[model samples]
Target: MRHPSPSSWAVISICIVAIVHLALGFSFGFSVDEAHYALYAQHLAWSYFDHPPLVGWIQWPLIALTTSEGVIRLIPEALWLISVSLVYRITLELHDVIQGRSSGYLTNVLPSGPSCGLMATLAVIAAPLPHVLSIGLLPDTLLTPLSLGLMLMALRWLRKERFSLGDWIITGVLLGLAGLSKYTAVFTVVALLMVFLSAKRKPWINQPGFWLAGIIACVLISPVFYWNWVNDWISFKYQIAHGAGGTWALRRVAAFIGIQIACFGPLMVVGVYFFLKQGWRNHRLTLLALLSFFFVPFTIFAALSGGGSLPHWTTPAWFCLAPFIGIGLAKAWSQQRRRLISSLFIVQIALCLIGFGFVLAGGPPSANLKANPMADLYGWQSAGQKAAELAHANNATGIAVQNWTLGSRAAWYAQPLPVYVLDQRQDQFDLWFGQLPLGANVILLNWSGLSYVPPTGKGAGFESCRLLDSLETRRFGQLLSTFDFSLCTNWRGADLVR
Candidate 1:
């Protein structure tokens, strides 16, 4: 029997992955970030407090048509598919470039470009975080494809002696889109510059195309700049303080490295080692160019990990290295290391499935609701519905959450009725529904995991409060969390803390 073509295999892999993501999307409730970003669409703006507008802009149309969680999730799923395809194309391009420069035992033994592309695409599928991103749209999901597109265009531009006008324009547009996607896109822009500068044949600095690309990128990202300007640059100030605010610790750095390895999966981790070893030996310039993409963001984030950076912040960097890792995996396959490859895939796939199950099961049942990390993804939908009903029955004007984190789901799940964060913190919620108005009756939602005591009396925000309902969230008959809904009347308003 003849084997399937590499392109055919890639299609099959993408389809299978999409089906799984679709199921997972339907199975889970909105994650804290997912709900938060989804709320972005409901309240349209140039940009948001914590992220740019692209994540919201991309979903605006679909959300207008329907608010189904699974349907809304299709946007990210489509973006993930595009990212996978781009990685394949990038691997093929890099493989061809490297092959042209060499002739010997290594070149002869290496798998074909198409095969390498397939392997790289599979490497992405084997990873866990990408799947989570697929289940819900995040800024990183948007950046992944935009970043890959910039890398591919950069590689093509580097291959030629003179830069093409079209390539420059495309790069500029992608950079702008990437900027709209996430602030981390600046790393991609820097990486592209490093690629051009580090190459043996330097790109002409005075070229009109280069300047045009810069202009285009600036034009595209003008909204973000304008928004920041209007908001007194609060977003920029917050990010700088957030990224570097934590105290440095040795264990934090070690934990960050461990998380990266686990998130990338053992197969891709090994692939990275092989990629660096082989690229440095044969294609030093190419290696440096690629490293520019990975190392800058990875190193900065790793260092900031000591300052409490999130794990997914390094995802785009890992994605930049995907093509080279694919090459490494392809070479291993050519050497008939089938057992090793099969074992790694099995382990990763199993882990991915187990993760999905954990989410589906609403995390492990525990007496302490805060101990279950997955509790966030479990009770929000039901709580939102319960809050809405209670508000209607009691003639409450809106729903109020003590923490900003709880506002997204309450606002999203209980639409048309505004959800307010009672806290004084300046967040996206503040930008949306501001503080609950004076003398307004509101249903205050309190989740056991992050519960807050309702303020009452003459000096407090409310005059008096009474328990409206208590909701117990369960999965397979196992209790996961409890949400308390309190009816609070006569808001007096408190002093703004920030």
Candidate 2:
């Protein structure tokens, strides 16, 4: 039998991955982030407190039409596939740049353009974090492809002496869309600037099209500024405090590095080594562009890891490096390292399967329900429904959670009823539901995973409170979490009742 071409293999890989993502989406409940972003759809706004509005705007139509978690997930799955295709396109661009080079070593090492593109696509699929993004939509999900598009445009511009009007417009629109996707996209703008300033010819600096691109991007991102202006810049303040809030710790930095290797897979690590070895000599400009995109945000996040940072914040940076990594891996395949490359792919596949198994099983039974990380994703659906029912039974005006993290799931699963966070911190929930009015009744939900006590004394927020129901959530006959619903009346705010 004849073997499939590299392009054919890429298509097959994408199809298979899509099917897997769809299955996972159907099998699991909405994750904490997923539910939070989905709630953004229900309440359409210029922007959100934690993120820009594109994530919610993209799903608004689907949310209006249906509430199925699986269907909502289709959006992210499609975005993931788009990101994969963009990576393939970027690999091809890299191949063309390398092929145009005079260096014999660079020319001899990399496989054909099609083969390089295939390897890059495969690298994205094998990565663990991309799979998670595919299963659930987040701000990063939308930003991934937009960031890749900006990188591709940068490469195309590098091929020419000057950028045309159309090129400038396209670049601006992509940058704008990226800004609308997430705040992290500012790194993309910085990367683009680095590429322009580092270029052999810098005449684009004096060009009219360049200024036009700036105006267009600013116009497109005006909503973020507009929303912040009206809201007293609360979102900006919150993000600043959030990212820089934690104390510095060496262990956090180490954990961050470990997560990058684990999520991106071991093969990409080898690929990075190869790129560093030959990239400077063979493709200096290309190396600079790719590295700027990858390292700018990556270095910031790594430094922030000592203070605090989420692993997924660097996803766009990892994606920006995919094309180069693809080329490196393709070279490895060309050399006699096929077995080693294959083993890495096998390990990645095994890790993906294990991750899915853990989700399906709703966390290990041996673990404490409160301590199980998977417990966050397992019990929200049941708990939300119980909260809603209890609220109705007790004639409560709304549902309350002690933390903002818990409000999203409750708000989403409970539907039109308002969900409020009883905590002191102001967040999206506070903006949406406002302070639960003084002397109002509410159904308080406390999950074993993130339990909190409802205050009921003379100095407490509530006048009186009693347990309404306890919901037990299980998967494969193993209890994953329990949620306690309490009916509390006459909330006098979180102050002494005089």
Candidate 3:
């Protein structure tokens, strides 16, 4: 078969990757974090106790457009475009390292340069997590682009051996943006430091640009720390508590590693080896990639210390290593089995489609604890709907839901009714609800657990609130079970309670 030009192959890779992700974005509902972030966006604040504010800020516009699932997903879909472009650029850059720009007929080394790009992009885009996770309004979408941007800039800085003040500013800005998107992004700084400190060429640490970049990153992340201080360090406590839940069973750790391999693909093994091979000779650049991997230790420490670490925490590790790995794969495959490389790309695309289809069909991914049997323990979307119906029957002017996943989804399905989120964590309900006039009909989707029965005394302030309906794990999907259960309200003057 005839070979295509390097540039042509890169284009083909990007198109396939972008198209696959675009489709995946349309197929799935917002995962839990996506829903949470979307709601968080609905009301802008400096930051959430659990995460930085970038996700909410990024998603704010999309949430305003339409409540439609597809509209909210557009942000993630858009990121895929940027991701693909960066992949192509990185691949081309990596190729140039070994096959210097002036080398004649570059075709001799990476004869199928464009095909190589195609393989790399497909490998990434075809992966289920990247596509599925990206589409939802989450931090990853924001982080992915910024991480890639930083990498590109880092490469340029590394190659030039001298970065201007502007270059440092741009690098710091991108890193800061990435940090806001996800805390794991702090690893990028570590990676850069390791590279600069170790690089034999120009000893990058002494340069002013390096310090400028560091200061910029610090400034960008200042808001997150500021919020933490104001909240009495509750965010830190919550994160620590959350991380403690995962036990340090060796099997679990092994399983988590296994999950990453399956999600990221076996090519990662090759990627690792490629780095090790290059690190042996090209020590400086290889160490930069290794530093990214060092983030896994941070994650493990978080897990072991009972600190929170999500599955995607290592995303930057894989992403930063992409360029070096791509070059290695290109070199090795060009000599050994170039034909199979395209086949691998095709398989990834196919897997992406199947994975998305399965999720849409109710075959939930591992990330969605909500889809597990424990969902009722969290909140039932269907139950929320039933609660809404009772509110309608009671002629309630507005229903007060706790304004979480269950509350929000209920509000979403039961539209047109004024729903107030008693976000007690923030003190809104406590401040205004007591002083404000009561609505004719009022229903409170309280979260103090089902045991807290409503007051039945004559002065209980409801003519009579009754248990209209209740929903639980056993009767999850059937709304009928929850429709009739309710806690009767106590009315001041009415004798209904008697």
Candidate 4:
């Protein structure tokens, strides 16, 4: 048998990398967000109160086939496979072209470059954030492709001043699709536009095709806002609530940064290192422009918006710096530091795996529970299951949770038990549930509203059967640490003694 060359091995490695990504879903249970997205996909609305509808829309087809957690998650996992493939293709193209352009070497494919491509692809795959998130269906998965597609298209257009009619249409459609995936993707377009206009070396901003694409994207994405307007812009209000300190404190921001570092892994380290190392050089300007225009605006927006910021909000910024990191890594490997670089890659991947396990264990080792964040991953599923069990035990018609994010997850886990909210906010929990007749079949409550012994000294009309305590605990920096959730049952809750 003929032995495979290094090039052949790299190709096989890339395939293995893709498989590893797909295999990851099996290890993790569904998170609250995953459960929410899975349940929400069933409805197929034009838009949702919290997010645009694309994630739900994308996952709907798979979900129609099976409610299996792994099956529903596979859709995004497939997308991630495609994403890794795209990175491989993109990196190879850049390497071949850059080699010819900079060094006047006409090489068909660099043996070393594919390894670099694999590294970048693996960086994305094993980053711990997208990998974990991709394991659960969410808009971010859909956004990943759309966002990268937009960047790829922009790079192509930047390389070539003249945009063909086909390029214009495809770019426009993808940008609009990306926006549909997540509203945050709008910032991506801003970054792309800046790249085009500021390309003084090869300016293409004055072209009608460019503006045409921009207009088409706007026209396509406008319907989301129009739908929001028709619904009193609840989505807008939700965004505002999320952005404007609804859950603000100094500690959350710091935690967000720390999570991001873990999420991006070695890739983030190289990207940050490159920025500082190559500051203000001509080649670095592209990255600097991208960082300044996109990350700066988005960061300020996130800090100010304050409703409830998640670390993923800053994911796009890290993306802008990835290509630069790729270039830096290539330089490092070429300069005979391959062993050192390889060691770092191995170490980074190991840390990420350890962290991923920590999350899956339901809490971190540092925490009191020693359960990893991944444990919280399925607490909602468990909570919902518990609700169903109680309903089955009591021979009740249904069981419901107090109004919160858990309502959807619990109702979803509870299945045949319809999940209902008394009202949007907490103060009305009693008013809403109290209105229900005495001897209510089942009601589930979370840590906050359930544990409350009202100042007026009334229980929320639910007798506690169990706390459904979180086996996992998560600390989002020092600002806020959320207990996963527990089910508090009210067998014969109360009267609307108002």
Model 4, 212-236: lDDT tens per residue? Answer: 8888888878878887888778787
TM-score of each: 0.94, 0.96, 0.74, 0.77
Q: lDDT of all predictions, in order shown?
A: 0.85, 0.86, 0.58, 0.59
Summarize candidate 2's per-residue lDDT along 172-233 as a digit string, tens digits: 89989999999989999999888887665558878999999999999999999999999999
Q: Count the backbone clashes (under 3 Å) in each candidate.
A: 0, 0, 24, 20
User: Model 3: what TM-score?
Assistant: 0.74
Looking at model 1, how many pairs of residues clash?
0
Worst 10 residues of 4 by lDDT: 448-457
Ranking by TM-score: 2, 1, 4, 3
Instruction: Please provide, for model 3 over 287-332, each residue's C-alpha lDDT reduced to its tens digit, 9 standing for 90 to 100.
Output: 3454453454345543454322456665555565565566656655
Tell how far residue 156 is off in model 3, in angstroms.
Answer: 1.5
Which candidate wins on lDDT?
Answer: 2
Pick by lDDT: 1 or 2, better one: 2
In angstroms, give how far residue 284 of model 3 lies from its true place. 5.6
Q: RMSD of each candidate? A: 2.4, 2.2, 6.8, 6.3
Error of 4 at 335 (Å): 2.5
Q: Is candidate 2 or candidate 4 better by TM-score?
A: 2
lDDT of 3: 0.58
Q: Give candidate 3 misplaced runs (Cα > 4 Å).
A: 1-6, 20-28, 99-115, 200-208, 274-309, 338-347, 364-389, 392-408, 411-498
> What lDDT score is found at residue 18 in candidate 1?
90
- In the predicted model 1, the residue pairs found to clash are none
Error of 2 at 489 (Å): 2.0
